[model samples]
Target: MKPQERSELIDALLDGAISEADFLRLEAELHVDEKARRDYYERLELTTLLEIQAEAEAADLEERIVPMPATGRRTAWFATAGIAAVILGAIALLSVVWAPDPAGGPLAAKIDSRLEPSATGFAVLTNQADAVWDSGGALTEGDLMPQGDLHLTSGVIQVEFFSGVTVILEGEADFTIHSPMEMSVRRGKLRARVPAPAKGFRIRTAEGELVDLGTEFGLDVTEQHSEVHVLDGEVEWSPKSEAMRRLAKGKAIRSGNGGGTVELSAQPGAFIDATGLEEKRAAVRASRRSAWLTHSRELRRDSRLLAYYPFDQPAHWNRTLTDESGSRLDGAIVAAQRSTDRFGFPAGALDFSPTGSRVRVNVPGEHRSLTFLCWVRIDSLDRWYNSLFLTDGHELGEPHWQIMDDGRLFFSVKKRDATKKQKDKQVFYSPAFWTPALSGRWLQIATTLDLDARKVTHYLNGKILSEEAIEDEYLVEIVRIGPASIGNWSDPSRDDPHFAVRNFNGSMDEFAIFGTALSATEIAELYENGKP
Candidate 1:
């Protein structure tokens, strides 16, 4: 790329407007071109210096100069006596704020590392029964198990390592996943079933480590001691101060924190096995599915609903999504595929990962207030704007609802006689609530625009996330949603041939639009009844 173009791309990166494609291109350039890397560091340093200068001016301390050591290639330029003292002082201050490597490495390398995507995991959270994590958010069944500390305060969870080792952990425990074949227990009980392919699976504890020899075993670890029980096969035990010994099935050993080991008979019933956990999860799923079905039936009868899509088609190839609210405003699926819903029912949801994938619908007439709600499982936020419901063309009185790339919930409406300036537009944003850890987990997202009350509210899983007042100058008395789309955006008035790609990278099982703003009690009830 040209120097000007590279600078523009760098500016966009700083401004948070660089597209994924452009970002990848810029990253590749920085990796191969030494000059580009230097330019990037120079740009970053200049930006930081400007910010410091602005702050100093604001504090009326611009005259003060602090001499600090400078490193890197910029040191020679700073040593020149011709440079302004204030600029040199600012550069010195910037160097202190962003200390470079003592060996004189470019700062671009550090910044580039931050731009790289997060590491991928080899294990998956296969199942959980009433699992309550210490982090507050429960891990969903299909979530990828991150390699880190896992604190389970209550219930049981099953994890399947890539090496074919299945581990069922009981609650009130602290565990860490070092790799697919290795883990550590600080405090808790767990049962592991290792197949022949994963024979050498390892488990470390405070006392020592246990190496599985294609065996099924139960391990309990606490501050005072660690215990191991060979449930079905042989395992090699190595205590901190004792010689490694192999123990067969029906044998158990306990090692105290201070020293010595005690032998005892194996207690297979002490830990919940994978099979038992599966049975419990199945029962809970069945109960939740039944309750959701009854709740869905009642929701269809709500008189204030403008349109409701259960996304429950009779067949996978069905293109029409029936409106359960009797509005006859059925949606036509466009290039989206049928997928599993939050309830684990096959072909019960619509996946909108592909380009041009959306559910096209038309709801006639304007409304004084509006509410948009849905249950979505976001796979990733790959686009600048991941659409939930956006009106076509974005004309006056039309509303747009979507999720920002940073995971904030966004809702806005075009006002009557509004100019192109962004300040004239009223937009509501909720604090970012989604993260990489939340990928594939089902979430209830809702947004209400109460023009009469002059307020907008956003909800996540039944609780209010944010509330913003609708300024009188920016409020549209009648909100319109004439021709719109679910999971994507369509701009009819755009002169450019290439359309913006804003399709949601995930699945949605249910969506509803209410004619009036729903109360918090009603939204909470909806979440309670529909949650899986």
Candidate 2:
């Protein structure tokens, strides 16, 4: 096809006006033509960029576009020629937008790195929490790291240096990165593994520099003292203005700023392996589930059961869940796709994307106390409120269990009391817990409301994360909080202005609702059996 004809076809395709025959013809031509494919992609990229720019500058464009005087002589031809010239100019501008100059300053920079390659495979961000990072934000695997200081205020981080050296830093650790081969742990616990090629790795603490002589070691530093524990192989501990001491495997040395050193046997188990961090976490979860399965049958006999949804529906999504509870409050999966990878269960889980997906359950009546339990694998905590379970709209005495954007688990109840002559709805929220990195991992969570005791409790991995006592005004019982749901909540009132925000983007399984508040032991049992 001619260049002008090809451009017309591309424009029609972009405008969604291309006929089926023309689309097939264009597809066939582009399939075998390298230049045509290149042209198409370039045009598509340029068009998308121009559209975004146009949206941003729409007001300015409207102000600038003044009506032109009527011209009769070849007006259509002139307009067509002008549009052709604009298209050519846009194609030319594509290269600059697609690939900018390397040394064009930070404004034109795509990645923030100091190296010539812009990224040195210095270390992999295995796991992190509350650690100060650069503008690039939460470092993941394969993210390049330039030489800089890593400050950990009150959370742990695991990093695997490219040289096969893995290091785990405890809280309050001040670590300076000199290169991939060298780093200084000024404070807190630094457990590292230096393999054959990375033997010269050194850690400079307050007292002295400990050089790894092909070893695995844990070094701790405090205000007045420092300790080095050699787990495997050996390390050379050199004190400031003092003689070097060769510490062998199974040995530990503690030295104070003022005096003599104390030597003892090293505990290898005390150190965590950064490379196997995720694996260890998975193993612990597996162990918990294994322990719970032993008594799952006995625990299922709890008399306070209101509803139990195993989410074992196959093929079809919009179906009633197997309600083990005799109350027959069957739940349903709505607008959720069944995950292909079952994550080890025979029945696959329902994945709820942030597109207003949910599982609904309309409990018939109210209860004095309530409990919600489920296993969730969170994809992100990006939204202000990501619902795990919610009962209807933001009405009084409705339970809303959700996770805040900061990875904190929250449980709230909207209470409106008539006895106290309170006209406004008062919300009671549970104490927040700093959740660890929860992406792509299954977690067992349970929340309980005891109206008699006027307390709310939250559990994770079978242990209590937070507990809050319900205030007197907020101790109202849950009364017919209909339109119960999981993964997302919707407002019932058409006049309500607030948009439904917390659409969960993750997988959920084994959702259970109890009529009475579960004790700590019962909560642990639920976690043990239901963990994936």
Question: Which structure among the candidates has the greatest TM-score?
Answer: 1
Consecutive 10-residue window with the lowest summed lDDT within model 1: 492-501
- Give the per-residue lDDT digits (tens) of candidate 2, residues 1-532: 7777777898899989999999998987786577888889988998996774454445457557433334552455345545676788789878876675677865434233211352454676666534444343555333444457766675456778878888887767677877688778667787888899999888787788888899899888887788999999999998876889999999999888776688888987766565445555455545644555445445456677777766656665355666666677777767777762223443457788837688778876788888888888777766778888887776777778888765667777766533445643434444544233336667788888888888888888789887888777666755445777888886634223342646887888777888888999978866655654
Model 1: per-residue Cα lDDT over 1-532, one tens digit each: 9999999999888778999999999997886688998999998898888765454344345576443325452544434433576687788889786676676664466445436654578788989988898999766776778668989999889999999999999989999998889999999999999999999999999899999999899999989999999999899999998999899999999999899999999999998897899888777777898899899998899999999998877497779999999989999999999998887788889999987899999999889999999999999886768999998867788898999776899898977543455453688999987775678889999999998899999999999999999887887778889999999988734532233658999999899999999999999999999998
RMSD of 1: 13.0
| TM-score for candidate 1, residues paired by index | 0.67
Query: Worst ten-residue run, lDDT, model 2?
Result: 110-119
Instruction: List TM-scores for all candidates, in order.
Output: 0.67, 0.49
Backbone clashes for every candidate come to 0, 1
lDDT of 2 at 294: 49
